[model samples]
Target: MRTTFDFSPLFRSSIGFDRMLNALETASRIETVDNWPPYDIAKTSEDDYRISMAVAGFAQDELDITQEQNMLMVSGQKAGEDKGEYLHRGIAGRAFQRRFELADHVKVVGASLVNGLLTIDLKREIPEEMKPRRIEIAADKAMPKGATKKIEGEKHAA
Candidate 1:
């Protein structure tokens, strides 16, 4: 089945860069291969998020996490053993690569492996100026009369 996406309307508006929308489209069109590792993404807070991948047989030294150009990549590669002869190989200890598109201003805090699970934490840091703030209007400022000078918008044309 073919799917269509009309993003012309979004481009016309001031919505800015549609990174999330693009990510959705990319994810939908991605082809699944044999080397797909199980993973989970969880939102810890308004600005905090965590991504965990199941790497049972992979060691800590074999896993690597890096952020490049707004993209988070996780890869793992198990070293081949020369001394052991595998009678039966059921568990997959092969190399795998996973990519995740990150939104603007999103940063990777850190990553750690514990109990056969690799956990990576991310945080979105919004500057104080970018955050929402309330503008308080003084009672005196609201009143137009008895003011030292007329405000720019206060004066009306006759």
Candidate 2:
């Protein structure tokens, strides 16, 4: 049986968190997802990330990687069926498509396939406007250095 979660309560008080809430809800809905061609996500640096996937028996031409919006898709398909027969076939040669949700500002840098491992590099580049900046507070406009002051109770001549 599949279970669903309600996020209506969080929607009322949360501001600018629609993406996070949606991702959480989406994850909850996919309870019995496939784990084919296992993969790992690792943080290489403060803003650098890497996704390594085991894709044995798959050639570079048979794999496709794409990014649209905040979603990254990686898929593999064998070119053709093997004509030779084997007494015991253990290696799995199946077509699979895996999707990953990426956070804002996260972009794919490069991808490589070496020794049956498909590694994808990513970098999070925060825009200049979004980065933290110190605001300069003016010191009350310096009070006009030579300005004259008058008493509150005294009257001024026109």
Candidate 3:
């Protein structure tokens, strides 16, 4: 099946280059791979996010995490150990690679391995100018005759 995205409106709007690049990067990465060593993305707060990946049989030293060009790459490689005898082996101790696309202003806070799961935290700090702000309008302004205020399709005439 083929999917289509209509981003014409966004391109015509005031979206910046960084945002456009980030969006395109995300779309491109989505077509690159499927779920492997399955993971979860959770939003802890308005500015914090957590990504947890199942990495059983892989030690903390065998994993690598890096952030490059707004992308987070996590990889794991397990070393073969000498064994006297083994009847059957079912656990996965092979190599795996995972990539995550991060938006602009997103930063990796830290990473930790617990109970065979690697958790990476990220935080996005929106600048003061980028945050949403409410503008307080003065109620003392005298409206001229036939003046009207339109808000969300509601028109109030004075």
Q: What overall lDDT goes with each candidate model?
A: 0.84, 0.94, 0.84
Judging by lDDT, tell me the better candidate of 2 and 3.
2
lDDT of 2 by residue, 89-151 (tens): 988889999999999999999999999999999999999999999999777555677897776
Query: TM-score for each prediction?
Result: 0.73, 0.84, 0.65
lDDT of 3 by residue, 1-158 (tens): 75666666666665567566547756855755656788999999998999999998888999999999778999998777647577887776778988887887899999999999999999998889998999998798878989998667767999
Report the lDDT tens digits of candidate 1 across residue range 51-147. 9988998888898898997999999988776467899987778789998888878999999999889999999998889889999976753656676
- Top candidate on TM-score is 2
Error of 1 at 119 (Å): 0.9
Worst 10 residues of 1 by lDDT: 141-150
lDDT of 3 at 46: 91
